[model samples]
Target chain A: MKNNKNTVDPFENEPDFLAQFDKKTPFSVPDHYFESLPEVINDKILKKKSLKFGFDKMSYRILGPSAALIALFFVVFHFYNTPSGNTVQPEEFSDALLNEVSVELDDYMIYDVYAEIIEETESSTEQTSGNETENDEYIDYLLENDIDINTIIEEL
Target chain B: MEHYSDDQLLSMFAARESANYAFNLIVRKYQERLYWHIRRMVIDHDDADDVLQNTFIKAWKGLDNFKNESQLYTWLYRIATNETITFLNKKRKRFLISFHDVEGELTGSLEQDHHFSGKEIELKLQKAILTLPEKQRLVFNMKYYDDMKYEDMSQILNTSVGALKASYHHAVKKIEEYFKNH
Candidate 1:
């Protein structure tokens, strides 16, 4: 290697002097240190995950029982649903939602629900063939029941 | 086990199920290289260990944001280098000392540490290298000791290759002068 007149090539010009520095270190690690590091790092990851998910926070831990108690309250209220004609009771609101989203139902659940509705409608239709009576019955029934008539009609 | 490419290892890391496994492989593969990279700077086993651990932990946290803009090794080397520099900076601040003061302390540590069994000449080279400014010492270590290319050092240091070449050139001249004068 030709060194420029003003420059010194310490590493290049030495007779294999640089060989000592290659991947060799005087630093020491504790015995089996590398073997244990993965576990240590994984533990750190687990802690990070817990923190990220808010699992370690009081809010999340409180959420578990509070959410359950709220659910229980709703379940108890549903069986004893209130009779409010104008205001939407929670139970009625939930039923309406379930019915709307039930559009994803398979053949059996839909058939079971529609079979009962159709039978009652057919039996009642025998009383009046005029559009006025049928329309009035369906619309009034739906309005009083707090059901969205359009949603059921669209689903069908 | 078959060796996985950097991309393949990264994909494995992306998966939650295999992330730990891939990380273990990564640690095993890169730990020694990173340790020495750090050890050369800190010159003490305990300090090097701390710096190396912090480097990997930081790398683990930053892995998601890694865009493969450079080689995986270079990214890791960059992290390790930065961590070493940060460790040294903290020591300097805490001790209320200058960069040269820190270098002098390191020189004392090197002589006293029982683990360093290098010959007097090797020790002289280390001290000479240490006398350079921290940035030049880093450049010299990577280029001279690691035999790293100027391009790779540029990626790791975020400096231009031309600048790295110049830095290496100047570092060598200083070290050679140290050897002659000492």
Candidate 2:
């Protein structure tokens, strides 16, 4: 009950109206609720920050190395298998190459290879012999006809 | 820990060096007022505590973006009000309760809660206040308890000043009727 002796209610038709009601709530709290609230709230803020920082550290420490390891594997695999720098090359066909391939070829095929080589040399020789002989014969006939050297130089 | 004006506090807060100090001051200064504001709506100390903490955390996170147009006090009040309303609405939804059921649940809280020491009439007053719509009750609490201005209430609720005045007026009449009969 309120000490309404010194007060008057605005709506006073009824002897006891609500305007005289004291507005103070009678709420209580557990001991030290307010005293500890700041620390409690600050602690929550700190926990959130630390969790975020921990995640960042975990990413840097763990995922960073994991990513590096994957990149290194790719680089090493690429270097070892790439065909440009370290691959072996043959300057010319070798007896070793011929022997290596001969097992896959037939006996006629080997003979055909030698025959083709022989035919190519014979054709080359025939082409050169005709040209040499024709040039020498023409020069000898000119000399036997006894043409003057100065006249030959001037007219021939 | 001497008293500093809101502007001094804000200017100190603007610098990264003194920001934490400024925030602490801000929290200490307004925590009690904001707590009671939320508590009246939610009707539970524990819920008020959670909502209050959330309100401050949000304020701290967004402090840099707080424009100086409105008073910081009203800004915080707005945040606290929204948080309380959201919490109450979610509480109803999470429990799958209707508005009346939620009211019954809150009314029930008055007895079960060890912290609530409201006398019979005060308890009755709370119950009567609860009978009004949530928004009307809110308007009533701010106007009756906090003596908040209609203009400030308008800014907080994003309602027109005329509407808030109307809401407060209806809320008062309902509570008066509740008292007259009971």
Candidate 3:
């Protein structure tokens, strides 16, 4: 309470010139500023409140769905991209397709396909054997005529 | 309009039904005093109006958290004072100017302000007060113009009474020196 005396008489040492000035503020306002301020302030408050509410609502309406859609997209992508035991991989797909074709074929159709494959294999072997015999005959002819084998091979 | 005590107003505001009504009453009661307080800090009436509106808006938002620890008037005053200071600081920051330069700008604007109806001496006194630091100016205004108690100012400013007195003393001496020089 050391300054209590000073606090009680704050203007005790005020200069005469300073004391002569009235306490009235130098500033003024537009007509009836106070009369309408409460309403103006209330309107502003309401506006601010609604603006905040609108932001929250917009988040729910837009951002919420956007987030959900992004999550769904990731989930779907992960579901398709990740290899699961029940899902067919690229390597397994061809085997699966062949198995499916085989299962779909009738007994007669399967027998026909197997027969055709066997016939093609036998023909290919016969052609190879014939080629080997021809090559042996050409070399024998070359030896019998005492022709230069290297020159005969080059001519052949 | 009927006058309601601060307790009555607080209790009315506590209820959802009468909250708006109570707030309107509170605004009506304190708007002029708060306006002048803000107007003095910010020389422009428009700026003061904006600051006052902001102060009330903040009060509306924060009143729920108010624990009635201090007087409602003082609490509202604190909000007004803070809003004014913030407005001034933002002006300074926006222009990238120092505090003293911002005050100089205010002084310049004061001359051009149509809302300023004060005589030449009053304007000179205002300019002299503007030379002090922000806190000293506030103390000087509160003490010299409003004659607010140092105790109430302590709660509003969150500063010690001794410091406030010293600030007021320094502000007075400085203003006197400024007048003597000019």
Task: Choose the strongest candidate by lDDT.
Answer: 3
The runs of at least 3 residues in candidate 2 whose Cα sits more than 4 Å from the true structure, single-residue gaps closed, are: A1-18, A56-156
- Candidate 1 off by > 4 Å: A1-23, A26-30, A51-156
Ranking by lDDT: 3, 1, 2
lDDT of 1 by residue, A1-156 (tens): 775864864434433434544334444566787787667766777787788778647566887789899999998898578565555433444466567643333333333344456556677757545644655565556556655434555665
Ranking by TM-score: 3, 2, 1
Best by the DockQ measure: 3
The candidates' DockQ values read 0.15, 0.20, 0.40
When 1 and 2 are scored with DockQ, the better candidate is 2
Tens digits of per-residue lDDT for model 1, B29-142: 888888878888999888988888888888888888889888889999999999999999999999999878999999998888777867677788889887999999999888
Please tell me which predicted candidate would have the highest TM-score against the true structure. 3
TM-score of 2: 0.66
> Model 3 chain A — which ten-residue stretch has the worst lDDT?
A102-111
Q: Candidate 3 on A1-156: residue-level lDDT in tens?
A: 486665676543555556868789988889988898999999988899899999999999998999999999999999988887654443353354445532333333333333344445657777555654554464455456655323422442
Q: What is the TM-score, restricted to chain A, for candidate 2?
A: 0.30
lDDT of 2 by residue, B1-182 (tens): 68888888899999989987888888888888898889888888989999999998889877899999989999999999999988988998999999767877887887677887878888888888888888898888887778787889889999988788788767778878988888
Q: Ten consecutive residues with minimal summed lDDT in candidate 2 chain B?
A: B110-119
Candidate 3 chain B TM?
A: 0.98
TM-scores for all candidates: the values are 0.64, 0.66, 0.72
* Structure candidate 3, residue pairs in collision: none
